[model samples]
Target: MRIVAAFLLLTVFAGLAIFLTFTSSWGSLLIPQAAANEAAVAVEEPTPMPDWEGKFVVETNQPVVLRTDPFVAAQAAGLLRKGEKVALKGCDVSGLWCQTEAGEWFVSYMVGTLPEGLPVLEGVKVQAAPTVAPLVPTADPAALMPTATPAAASVLLMLPTPTPAPTVLPQAIVADAANLRAGPGTSYAIVGSANFGESLSLAGRTDNGEWFQTDGGAWIAGFLLSDPPAGLPVVEPPAE
Candidate 1:
């Protein structure tokens, strides 16, 4: 009986030792691997920026200049007043510069989302450079005196008068029924309408030549009209 009890105790002790060794080795190896897997799962990719579209308001204290190009050194195409509403066309890859539907470019930092239930900003003013008067040469007092003979005066009077160059004003007749919009693009709100055979005075054209501004301050698609006048100046449509 003593021999049997001693063998039983030895077998129990051996089994306990094997179980502890196996558990210790597995815990040491698997615990670090589990921690590494959890850490890898916790590290995630960054979130992307939201795609912004629609009308944005100029939130700056002072007026901001809209440029013909996206860069700072580009020509000042127009001025955007504080609290004015501007239609956003798209933004650069960095989302810093935004282009208007009218094709004017401005910095995105100066603009903010237009809030609902608020009256749109007013007193928006455009600054155009004053036209300079042509200088006239002063006439000499001696030259003013009648130094020519009667025959010379007769010959000068007989000389043919110079013909003036013809001025060509841009005009267009609507070939089809068209919608006159507030801005140069079709996305702008329809402010007026044009019937077939309606004649409109052309003031300017959009940069892409796809739209034309009428003398009535409305925009119409150029494709709806006959070919525009050859000498008409291209003007930048105001940002809506």
Candidate 2:
């Protein structure tokens, strides 16, 4: 009878050990899977960009090549300007480049060249503006008077009208690596950036040497219209 009792006790102990081993192994495997799933859920999503399109400037001195097509091996058709506005189509996140409407692709450094006064397209489509005519002065002083005024009142307009300030537009450049800023001084904020071998427009300037024009839909300053920096190449725009 005692042998029978010992055998039954040994059988019960063996069954308990097998159950514990299986339970521990299953728990270990499940815990890691649960932790992995939690980690995946904690990750954040990427932000989306606007659907509108416009231009960007080159902020570096390095020569950036733009091909007739987006592929690298495509024939080199044209060059870009520093602070020059090119039509942007969309952003390519995987490639880290902006694809221009003209099918040109450029990196971020090339797009930061202009900061302030850059024209923006927003969601609205706009036609390119007509060139502004130069303001010319007339010799007849009396002709400057308002026509709606009485003859006696017109004579009182003797106060010489201040000469209209010259309407200077920003000039464009076809070089690589231009600068853009809020003001003419280097201390001013670097509101824009650019890449190498880019062309740009010089709209106007201040006496302090600050340049102002549209860069990527905003106004920025850095380069001037006077002279191209030494070692930089300049390309003329195709004839209209």
Question: Best-fitting candidate, measured by TM-score?
Answer: 1
User: Per-residue lDDT tens digits of candidate 2, residues 1-240?
Assistant: 999999999999999999999999999999999999999988867788544443443344433556454333234556665445555555543333445667665443445543344343334222122234454654564566556568666676666666755544344553335456555444456677655545655544333222344434333333222232221112222122
Report, for all candidates in order, the number of backbone clashes: 0, 50
What's the TM-score of each model vs. the native? 0.31, 0.24
The 10 consecutive residues of candidate 2 with the worst lDDT sum are 229-238
lDDT of 1 by residue, 163-183 (tens): 545434468987656779999
Off by over 4 Å in 1: 1-168
